[model samples]
Target chain A: MSVGYVSVQWNRHKRIYDACVAGGIVLYLGVFFAAGKALYTGRNAISGEILAMRALATCAFLMLNVILCIGPLARLDRRFLPLLYNRRHLGVATFLVALAHAAIAIGFYHGFGNVNPFVALLTSNTNFTSLSAFPYQTLGLFALLILFLMAATSHDFWLKNLGAPAWKRLHMLVYIAYGLLVMHVALGILQTQRSPWLASLVGVGVVIVATLHLIAGQRERRHDERGSQLSPRAGEEWVDVGAVDDIADQRGSTVTVGAGERIALFRYNGCVSATTNVCAHQGGPLGEGKIIDGCITCPWHGWQYRPADGRSPPPFAEKIHTYRVRVVGRRIQVDPTPLPPGTAVEPARVEEVQSA
Target chain B: MPGLILLGASIYATVGTLFGAGFVLRGVERVDPAALGAPWTFRILILPGVIALWPLMAWRWWCAPRTRGAA
Candidate 1:
């Protein structure tokens, strides 16, 4: 029912969202052309050094758009599926532009009355003759070829014909293309410009991407470690820990539920609370994340969940499945049966004892 | 002036085609060339547009319809 409601809301504004995206593209194109014209005025734009730079910029822009579409599409609901449904049109358009960029680059930069455009492209700059000439142009050529393959197979028809796994494996070459592009830009343009600001921008962008991936990777490793520690034991099944007092207030302790699911339990005042240790967003360990005013916040995207009920706060009502926990004498026992939304479960309480 | 105009035309066509194709692929219609309005508008729009397209393409692929009969 909730998913359906969310879907309906998304559908209501679908056209507006689509139109906004379309408008943004038109505006960007207008600027690109105007800039190109302003830069190269009067010369053969199709076959010039300045045009080559423009082409590279175009390829880079298209690639960036492709990257942006991944996150929102992954999370879109049934009503939002239309955004994903027509995504191929966008992919095809990007490819065509990239092709234009590559074509003009080859024709203008390497052709220009030179003998055999392909040969000229390959052998025009042989400054680095050692180590098989390194063939810098070939890197771009292969990248372009890979981009062509990806664009050609962007439609569902090719996806069905080629099979998903094979198609996906082939499409994975985008990363390779990305690396090649970086090398192409670094060697081709950056070396010539030697501008500190440009270098800093490139360096900063790479660093941010690397950092996000590294954090995501660390979260996955922690989940694996927790899983291994909680494998099913004979007859005993659930692991028994000595009193709720063992858990420090405000800090969460990792507990292994049956079937190797790792959960973090936090004790506040006299109330006990629990939630999945792994965050839904990028698997950030909830166990490691700090508690803020009785809510556990995922460090990755700042998604917060009430530890007592495992329900996300208002404006974000997503909920993670919760486990049943009870205190039997000195032993703390947790039930593996998962609770659904709106089901009320009483939190276990520990009696306070004064030390002499 | 004619020489400059010719050079400008060529650059415009080349850059326009590249960016135009990019805009279409990202489903970005109704683009406002004057959004930033002259001066730095070219760098502002084109640079971000170029940087943003790759992730958009990847999003498209991931969100594309799954092949039937495949898990």
Candidate 2:
């Protein structure tokens, strides 16, 4: 929320969040290495280098799973919202750990060969057609490249410059990267080791991620469908959303207008105002956010916009479309037509409707 | 085969480094007023991104309207 950019607008929450991430990474790696040594002894012993590589690889995979889960989990329940706040840090950390694993594996396997390690990584495994001996390293490499691009552009500077839509489209490549990494593990270790436990772990992770996303998607679809039912039909001027009391003070209730145009109706200072449900920063659900200090704050990153005009306060040049709202006999009705972004429409006073 | 790729990457990175140094020092403020008066840490933190994206930065630097206080 700064007028100007610093490296990061680091605060107490971010500091604590990063500390927890660091501690968890260290603990996971330590336990992994220790368990490997204790479990696999003498005849089936693994070297320290291999153990380190495996530890980092597993840690990165688990971190990625958690990262993917955080969004759907947050949508399902607000308690997980705290996890969503510092997710990019976790993502960057995942890349670093994965890079470490790649470095170790490449060096150990191909560093001593006649050609470059990367070249050996690409050329040594030319058996792409064979399912049993496919070039899984290439999948991992491409995934790493995607991760690197994401980590590189994770800053607000890039977000602001690229515009939210383009930035979002670019970051959505994470799904592809996730898919690649999944295949990388399936084809790499699962093929060679034939470890049931590892296979089960990957299977469970994929299931959990898929299930959570499906559940969240269903919930959102239902919300939109409900809004659609309440929307104004042909020739109808205003659509009745619900009673003003349905929205809590300083809180919002989302309604879908004509053809899936989602609007967030906010109640504040005895008046009701409406704005587009989409946040300008990250397309976060603005309806789920509350009015903080006379401004509607985005739940995702706390970017605020004045509910009256849908404008972010001075020095923050973001805006969302405003909708015309009216209260008639305690019932809130919003015009299906949207005004331009930052257009000021008079709010309908709840007290006026109550008195009438 | 890998040596050629590595050499090309090295060259690109070298050019990026030089361009990034100048962009961070003199050109950043012109493109983004927010970067003006930003600390050394901020500049250093953005160095890698700037290096990786030097061409884009250069394009923005060349085209974006000059902000106040930028020399």
Candidate 3:
């Protein structure tokens, strides 16, 4: 992170990630175009423009599916975290492709009329009563608008200006967009085409996305339940977290205290410290992240904060709430009350507790 | 009706363009200190977002804490 915002702080990994996305898009479009040409010929001939639209549309849809899956996939397994890192790049690319497809489609189908292409596109289709004749283009248009909003605000500037919570809520409109697109496909193309493959593909995608999310949600619920089961130690208000040794060196384990407030207990340098599990940036799960270079690093965007003070290092000004923690025997106990952001709390020494 | 809608959109676009020009040049630095020394290319890239969100940005600019010589 930089003190001042640049367009993007390009790194070797970002470069490689972007290159792979670009190469994949180009390869997919090429294959789609070639396949369309080879299969649809003579009586079943399709125009190159229509073919291009189809290619971009399908590619954008698949990209969005992958984008939606990445979140739960990362939560399910740490190995998928790299995919979650630069997922916004894929999102922006998908929007661009979808925009191109929409532009070509509107220009081809509606531009020939005297009415404005957009107006024609929306107003020409009025047979909404019949499922087959539903105005699917309007659904597609709404979804595109949502995608455009997201893509436009994908930069850090918007995130900072909008505040993380509001920005996150706004971005969650993607689910609505996805739903609209599904209807757009089912009603528009599926009605005309006598193909089970497209229907099966969409069904399978929905199932996989739903299944992964359910599994991840269940796992998170179980984790929270386990943490919640640990009551305040005897009469003391300090909640008993799990064993100090259970948290690996330079790693964190989360515990839920009073009313489901999750706190991450991090062990570093033979001492234990506690901080809020929510990252200051994007609210990433700090508990899932490990401490690197003596700082707790957020898994989502590599935002780092000192484990003791919960403050980002110099020049960058981000902070999270810290909690007073102590090691009682082998178990780490933390005060339920949270100190103000960046408040320094003394780390409890594991050796001292063991010796006592 | 289509013509009226198109005209309204054109007016919105024009207003957005004017607002965006001022925002990228001066209003940005006032609202966000991090945008103070941002590169021209970055500013250009953020213009669409600024235009789309001009009302909010303008409000922020208006309510920005006054630094010495900022007023």
Model 2: residues >4 Å from true position, as ranges? A233-236, A352-356, B1-8, B66-71
Please say which candidate is ahead in lDDT: 1 or 3.
3
Highest-lDDT candidate: 3
Q: Report lDDT (Cα) of residue A66, candidate 1.
A: 50
Residue by residue across A1-356, what tens digits does model 3's lDDT show? Answer: 64888988788888999999999999999999999999999999999999999999999999999999999999999999999999889999999999999999999999998888988986887888989788899899999989988988888988889998999999999999999999998887766788889888888888898899899999989888877777776778887777887988889888897565799889989999999999988999999899898899999889999999999999888999999999988888889888999999999998834444
Which residue pairs in candidate 2 collide? none
Tell me the lDDT of candidate 2: 0.88
Give TM per candidate.
0.46, 0.93, 0.95
Q: Please state the Cα-based DockQ of model 2 relative to the true two-chain complex.
A: 0.53
TM-score of 1: 0.46
Give candidate 3's error at residue A213 in angstroms: 1.5
Question: Could you give candidate 1's per-residue lDDT for residues A249-327 as a string of tens digits?
Answer: 7666666543456676767776666666766533445765557877877543355777777777776656776666767
Model 2 lDDT tens row, B10-64: 8989999999999888887788887779888778877777888888889988998
Each predicted complex: what DockQ? 0.03, 0.53, 0.58
DockQ of 3: 0.58
Per-candidate RMSD, Å: 14.2, 2.4, 2.3
| Candidate 3 lDDT, B1-71, residue by residue in tens | 75577678678768888999998888888888888878988888788887777788889889987681263
The candidate, 1 or 3, that scores higher on DockQ is: 3
Q: If ranked by TM-score, best first, what sequence of candidates would result?
A: 3, 2, 1
